[model samples]
Target: MANIAPPVEDIAPDALLDASSSLLSEHPDKDRLFEQLAISADRAAVAGAADTAVGLAALAVQVLEEIGGEPARLGTALAALGRLEYERGNPDLEPLERAADLCDDLDEPVVSATAYAYLGAALVALDRPGDALAAVSWSLAEQERVLRVQPELRPTLKPVRAEADRARGLACRALGRAPEAMDYLARAVEAALPRTPAQRLKIAEAATLLVEDLLAEERPEEAMPYAEIAITALGDGFAVKAALGRQRLIRCHLMAGGLAAAHPLIEALIEEARAVPGDLTFRAVLADSLAQSAELLPLLAEDGGERAAERGRESVAIYDELLAAGVEAEGVHTGRAAAALALAYALELCGKHADAVAPLREAVDTLERYAPGNEQLTGYLARALLMLGDALVESGQAMEAAEVLRRATELEPVTTPPR
Candidate 1:
């Protein structure tokens, strides 16, 4: 009898990896070792130890490759590793491509379908939408063939089907087939409907994509429900994702001209950001979002200027903290500049042009320091200079305003095309 490994849930991720490594060194049943490693990797991923999961999955593939394991086993290991890598935001197409090639030579329809599905997803992430479409087409066809032969596996393949559909939707969108993308994304959402708690994340992902599509098309009413669905599905456990969902929901309301509806959501997002123990990137994102809300709200509501000023101050404070912390990333500097610009705009909206001059000067100085010679930032620098000139004029600094305006006009034209 083959040696079966103990349950992964019974051990810590680090301990399981250590044990798996020790077992590999002993040369005990190679196939069984591969299975144990694969199981451990999946369990680690489920437990949110993404790095450990990728390590285990990579080890599994290495073990199989070293011993010249069967193509089916090797393909499975490669596919698992590729999937984990993609989830970890460091996608590489090599493993997934190799897994798909191996599947082509095997008779295991389910494994072939699963491998292709993962390949399609990775291709989408890598921005090869045309290739992604072909891969997902093969995956869906293979899945259909399996269902024809063994309908009983339908329940097991729901998540796989949803994954394939979502990949197809993203591929179509990238290919500029808007209507087709919407249909596929809607199907993906339906296919991902939760049958268990574990399935909720899938549903949230699909719904989020669909909402983005709808929002892009200016169909905010259609986007609202899916945005809400994504937020509800994420619940409290996935704070970052839930906050993103709220941001999307807020956009839906704002686009539909419901400033009142968006207000509470914006506040909720601020509260969530403050409550969550997130890293610098999350804080930067929250600050940017607040600045954007502050800039937009004043355009939508009569009483919004005061609220915008409040949020703008908060955004500027966060950016100031980030800068004081010695974060030197270009994005951090740009975000701080943008926060200052937004605060100035809010202050001007509140009829405080004199007060706005200070922030406008800060924005102009920041951009002048960081944006020159960078094509992408040229327009931003010019805009900041122009705004600063106007603020100076309003604050009765006519001579300074003339020089600032002349400098703004001397900037090279921003000719870079949008992506």
Candidate 2:
């Protein structure tokens, strides 16, 4: 909903009020007055005077309820209010539902379809994807009906239909129907072209979602173009969106075996993450990401031990800071374990077998405490145990090494392909 643009209008508040006051003073027809109020409210919303828009929309609804005006016209005013709330990123679905009902009562296909589209969008925000999908499907059916019966309404209905398509795509993605989602989102992006900056932001956001779905399906090559499009569409003004796009691109490069490309991209992302204000979480996460990525760094320019140790220490420092800042310990348990494991590996790489023992033990203890009996974490836990056993044996702790190796053997053994 943050992607939606308000009604396109540019009217001065005082002048608009004065003109509306003078016109109302002449006792205009009730229905016409409702239309006038609706127009003013929409303009106010577009001009960023949300309070004024709400007041005017409320007045229009009051006139309709009291004077028995056209139901379709009343629905139009209600739907406008819904659009205002949606553009503000917190849509209230009740009014949109009411508007849809009112339009249905009037047999107004077009307005009802638009109302359903907004309702679906609100439902998507609420995380009710199944219900949202149903609403959007209804909206699309109505749109098709209207287009077939009243071709002249195309100019007015095209954008609303596009909105419904986008909503459907979002709902489908939420339901794990990625291929269908990609298709609908692609259509929506095409339809939303030549829009204002605010509206184009929505297209960029949709493209980003498509990219995510593609990447999740392990189709990095297929996701690259959409990631590029999203990055370009985010422009320079929205730093968060641009950063997210860059991160996705970096992941794509790494997954596609473009390690040299990913190296500089990862560095750039780390720099940007450090510059983000108000939260240290992004920096902590990026530090961890860099530590993992650096494992792929070569030993020609720098020894594997030194490179891994550098990243491992950087990650540990950030993790400690995050903990000191009151970040929940449970939330970072996996990260802490991973950092310790990396440090232990780096020590082993440098032939400091005894020095690696403490970190390996710590990693094993952390994982055992937090993730006991969890199959998904079994592989990681087993690796830590194996490393600890190896370090213990090398340090002449034969009994401890035997015990650790026994535990490691009890857990599942995992295989890694040669790098």
Candidate 3:
């Protein structure tokens, strides 16, 4: 909610409902609920608690009970609270399950449907795809049940339709069914985008996750445009966005073999690193981007990529300092990521393939430990494995090289499938 767009009154209800609050025709103090969510999200960001999201949502629920259970407030509160939990990484399904029961008690179709949307996302995150699928199905079931009993609610259907679409799409993605996922996610994006503040956030988040999956499948070209839109949508003031933007930009440039254009950005990123909180992952990503840009420099210049590589190396050194000073998991992941890329280039150029193995292996271990399930770290993994293979071959270990390459190739292909 901290970086989320402010709600606009004139937009369609779907865009409106998908955000910090939901639409309930009966609740008083509903607006206050939205404001509280915003404040809590912002506070949680700086505080960085694992349970900050749930704690904030719980507070909202307490406030709702004081408002006399206006139907409007109830639905709106449930939607907001549900979405917040989904973002906070709560996958228990119990919170959402209880929310659905609350909506059912009030006989609110719109709220009921949206609750299912929340349920679907939570189920997916928890790795219960079938249940996630069933939860969405149940949500639709509840929606129909409500509309049949209360025909008056049918008119405000756009956001509900869109919400359902987004939820279903999320389930598809979790199933690893990309084609179905793409179709559903695209519709959800269309339905929720530019309208629902919450939905747009979902669209942006989904797009980012999808692009990463695509890239992991090694389909950079397919992921490129999504990554671009995602970066733009991420706006400013969000540290994660800053890191993701540079990551895709550097990658796209590399895929296009346009190292020159990437050079200055890489330089700028290194400089940018100096000003940011040393512990932030953004600095680490900047460091890695610098390293990647440096490695590409040789492909575009006569002087070789060493200059950029050297600058990147310097940036990496700063990240090292931050880590030594007790940098968080974020710093560890990003620093490891940058170091891995830089080390690969350094070892390859210096003909020290044997020595390169240790750093590459360490990079892999560090990234896996600190940034598990993260797309960028996955990229680092791919790069490290490839480098190890290259080094093994360089050092007259063709058998080992072949084994490594085979493993890298296998790991790389599934990550980025065709759009």
Candidate 4:
């Protein structure tokens, strides 16, 4: 039962502060939602010898057949099994293995195809995109073949179509096909079908991929609603959910040219990264976040407009952090992060007529050294060159600056953030 709350005046500063910082404050009803999930998990985890449990159990094994015991899918299956194991408070690979076995026993191609989708999902989560792509492809082929010839299985296949679309959409997105990925995912969401726990997860994946795609298209205004849906579905306790939430929030600010307003969210993600012991991705992105964050800093200066001086200061700070991180060994992604930051600052202060020689040279040098031939790196390389040219012009090297800028124009246009 709900209790009467105390008067607002009676609350202490610490109490109010703590309440504001609670999970519910950050995410709508997260605590209660997680509690209910735990409850559902508890109830469903207890497998009886009933027909339903036995059927699902066999289906698990069938999925294993399609997976062929690859280590990637095996690890994915193991993690899912681990969650079930924790819930049951006993060693229980039986449920997972049972489902795999069922996939093999099911005579219907549609049912087998659905099982393969689940098995493929396990591979996807294990960072084995190749295996995931292959598995999803096979599942789609089976589903298509069955749907065309064996219309008898339409009852099951129809219900599973949205799930298949959703899974395939996520795989395509992970493989980096933003436009095609969104097409399939849009079908899944428009289906508006009820989701089992399995389908619910696919929904979350599709939503996240769609969100990333929207942002890359320079359409956060379009992405915001999808991000909201994903947050509402995934809740804050899940790791990827939390990380994505932080990124979307920061992006929302940047899209508005309001990066200063994003300090709280940026600081929170920074702290979250710090809390994770040895989180390399978190650390690398944290450096970029810091740079992305300075977008709101004022670029204008009084008389002679010490813009380059101010810009140089910001660039130096970021470079110092990159040096601290030993970013040279971290790959082009990390190095481009720092270079992009300096380049942004240099371009902003272009009219300063200051000795752009040092920072501009440093920016291009760092980018040239670090940017490998990766697609995303190529985009960063373009931005760096554009700013380097601006610096050259400011230093009374107009001809050289024009040449560099022309070179920048030859790069493939960058329209979105990299995943």
Between candidates 3 and 4, name the one with more favorable TM-score: 3
Better of 1 and 4 by TM-score: 1
Model 3, TM vs. native:
0.57
What's model 1's overall lDDT?
A: 0.79
lDDT of residue 160 for candidate 1: 82
TM-scores for the candidates: 0.66, 0.72, 0.57, 0.49
- Give lDDT tens digits, candidate 1, residues 1-419: 12444544456666867776566677457776677778888777776677888888988898899899999888888888887887776888889889889989888778888888878988888899999999999999999999999999998888788878888988898898989988887887766744333346656887888888787677999999889888887764676777778878887887787877776677667666777545775687678778877876776564447878887888889888888888778877877777787788888877888898888888878888888678657777787788888888898999999999999889987642211
Q: Candidate 2: lDDT over CA atoms?
A: 0.74
Task: Write down the worst ten-residue block by lDDT for model 3.
Answer: 410-419
Output the worst ten-in-a-row residue range by lDDT, candidate 1. Answer: 1-10
Residues 250-298, candidate 2: write the lDDT tens digits. 7677667677777777777777777773566576656666565445553
Report the C-alpha lDDT of model 4 over 1-419, residue by residue, as the tens digit.
11225422233323322343332233343333233323333334342212222222223323444336543333333334433442223333343334445555545455456555555555555555566566567667878889789778766665456656665666777787767779988777656354333334446657777777777677776776676666555543356555656677577656755545566676577567656636655655555554543433332222132343343354356446556777656453344444344444544555543454565566666666555675666666677677678767767789988989998898788753422
Candidates ranked, most accurate by TM-score first: 2, 1, 3, 4
Q: What TM-score should be assigned to candidate 2?
A: 0.72
Model 3 per-residue lDDT tens digits across residues 224-265: 777666666555445566566666766665655556766776
